[model samples]
Target: MELLLKPIIEKPNETGSGHIKAAAPVRWALASLSLSMLMPSLSTSIANIALPTLAQAFGASFQQVQWIVLAYLLAITTLIVSVGKLGDIFGRRRLLLIGISLFTLASLFCGIAPTLSLLLAARGLQGLGAAMMMALTVAMVGGTVPKERTGSAMGLLGTMSAIGTTLGPSLGGILIAGFGWETIFLVNVPLGIANLLLAAHFLPADRPNAKTMQGRPDAIGTLLLALTLAAYALAMTMGRGSFGAVNIGLLLATAFGAALFLLAQAKVKSPLLRLSMFRDSTLTAGLAMSTLVSTVMMATLVVGPFYLSSALGFDAAEVGAIMSAGPLVAALMGVPAGRIVDRFGTHRMTITGLVGMIAGLFLLSAMQGRFGAAGYIGPIAIVTANYALFQAANNTMIMTDIQPEQRGVISGMLNLSRNLGLITGASVMGAVFTFASGVADITAAHAEAVAAGMQITFIIAALLIVATLGVALAGLAFARRASLLEEVS
Candidate 1:
């Protein structure tokens, strides 16, 4: 067991604190991560605001407009893991620059796209670029930062992510209303260019080991994984009832691909995904928590606009304002949450955050139709706080457990899990909304059915939160027991 773990556990020598420079490398990496994190949230919110306009411009149906959002997410989800692995096999910094360039180019294409199909394709490519940036940013952090200060640095990174999430919708709304839909993508152009230049100047070059450099990428495994993710994403997007023969086939293919991928990984000399990493209990639990939290968080993103707009009669700007509330709280809470995690350990923070999240969800579920816009203030605030604490805590926990060498793969996988969770939540909530609203017209029933559906979804999300709390408690207990055993020995 020790021999098996030895290769996995060995990490690069920590950079000396005194030698660590505050100049270009750290700044560029941080900048890149911040911008990359901003893209998804920005795109999601911007598109939410632009959906009506897009429909008017293209004569698109509601369902087709939904694709404008789903297409980008699917692209990110599909390519993230592969891109992350490539970062490891190739060079993290090199890939980061390439990703940024691709992202900028994609943004340009999206801004000028003539047709709906072209726009969707451009968005997909943009997602691919975003994935590359996301996949490498943290790994780059691990590589560049001194071990002693890594936690603080990551906290800062989390803060940037929180800010991005907060600003995405609000800024997007402003841009769309003031200029046009093109401004949304155009916004990324300058930011992406800045990130690219910074990355080129500051990010460290990845020096691959002889073995890694010589090793071939697992082409078969990559295809299988892509197939699996694509199928699963498609199934979720299509919804359960809407799934026809093709969707069913895709689901089956996903299962087959996943099975084959795992089998191949077990046999391959150099696997793309290191299955051995799952042997660590902390890593496993951290990944699980990340997935659950992301699912719950994404449910809010999917359902919040509908609840605000349809239920409360909020327009695009109003919806953006209401939606921005959570991310703002998240941004405020991120740094404190990270500091707390460092001092008190991840388990307590995770438990507390999960509990807060459950409370928030329950509050949301209890919203009355008669209640005005102000009535939702409490629920939204609580949800935002929960999001802040949960994200910071979960990230701290996961990164603490993994060795530096494995950071790229682990970070990539964690991100992939989060993306998958987001897609799942969006799809499930979409289905729920459709079913609930179909039974009651918005005019006749006045969002009661939609509220009911949202309540059920929130309840399910709350249950997941409870499950996370249970895991956190168990982990704490295990840690206590291990400490006692160590003392006794």
Candidate 2:
């Protein structure tokens, strides 16, 4: 390792404090990883905007059209961790290469599908491939970048994702207008092929490491984890439309599956997820806070369109345009915010972000009655910027200084928390809005009632954020005390 790094870096005597610049290869790896990450995220967002066009193309019903998106989401969310574990076992690079190949092939199938069913099947295949790529992209980025600059590297990756997600709707509209819905999926083909060639040429070979799992992957644990995620995600997705006994049963089954998964991991010789890793209090705290932040931020996204269109009487097109501002701001600020995290540390940036989110939520709540969606663009921008900084920093805070081998599972855990948070945030915020509006029929709700409900929803969101802030502060204190004790010892 030292030999590989030596040629690319200045000597410690020459550079001040043993600082090493990342090699050309490392920079290439980061760029490659970022582009790889961007495509999957962009694909999802683009697909969302193309759904109406697809429905018309296939003459599909609302439920069937919805499945086109849900199938991909479900497949990706459920399989992310499992594939991450596989990366640790076989090799991330190998898994990544395979994933890109599969994704490229799946996109081809999606583009030429003769029927809606085939398209949905192709989408699911595409999601499976995306899951593998997403699972390892961050880990690979961390592996190659200089340790001191991990936050900055991650920030760059986040920026790519932010841009991809935020750019999706407008890009999709343009493609669908000038070309067709098929163009969206087909657009990925060339990009995927180019990325594949880049990966094949640039990325270093993955070799056996001390950190790779030695024995067979945990079959029972894998099954249980899949079940738990599937049940939970499905329950959350289904709950929005129907909150009946089946949904309740699914929720119960999710809990049951989770318990079994925990038990299975404990007993397994080589567990898919290493439960022991949580022994690090920092990792636990970061994951918990990540879950909370994801819940609030994503839930805010869930409500934004409804608030804009239903309450503020903005057109759908206008709502989409305004909503893009937040993510665009996030994309713009991501690298700078990450540099700050590298300079100061995760705790300070996270606290700053938490405070910003609370302020943004309060501002949104206060201004909704007066300025409505017209006044929302700036506040949401602030909120997303806070999220960008917090995510870029806090994500690395737990795994940043850890052993390289542990990265696969840790990265997977991070992804899992974010996905789980999105589901939780959307569900909780939806329930709060429903209760506050006192309207069983969302489509029929009065504009005044929706406006009132949105305000209450923001207030509730702010309160939840406050609780997360408290826990994060406590965790920060704990880490400081531990550092002091280590110094004394």
Q: Pick the candidate with the highest TM-score.
A: 2
Model 2 spans with C-alpha error above 4 angstroms:
1-23, 239-242, 372-374
Q: What's the residue-level lDDT of 88 in candidate 2? A: 76
Candidate 2 residue 174 C-alpha distance from true site, Å: 1.5
Angstrom error of the Cα, residue 345, model 1: value is 2.3
Clashing pairs in 2: none
Q: lDDT per residue, candidate 1, 273-384, as tens digits?
A: 8798777777777778778777778778777777777767789778777677777777766656656666676667778878888898888888745466666767877877
TM-score of each: 0.86, 0.94
Best lDDT among the predictions, by candidate number: 2
Backbone clash tally for model 1?
0
Model 2 TM-score, 2 decimals:
0.94
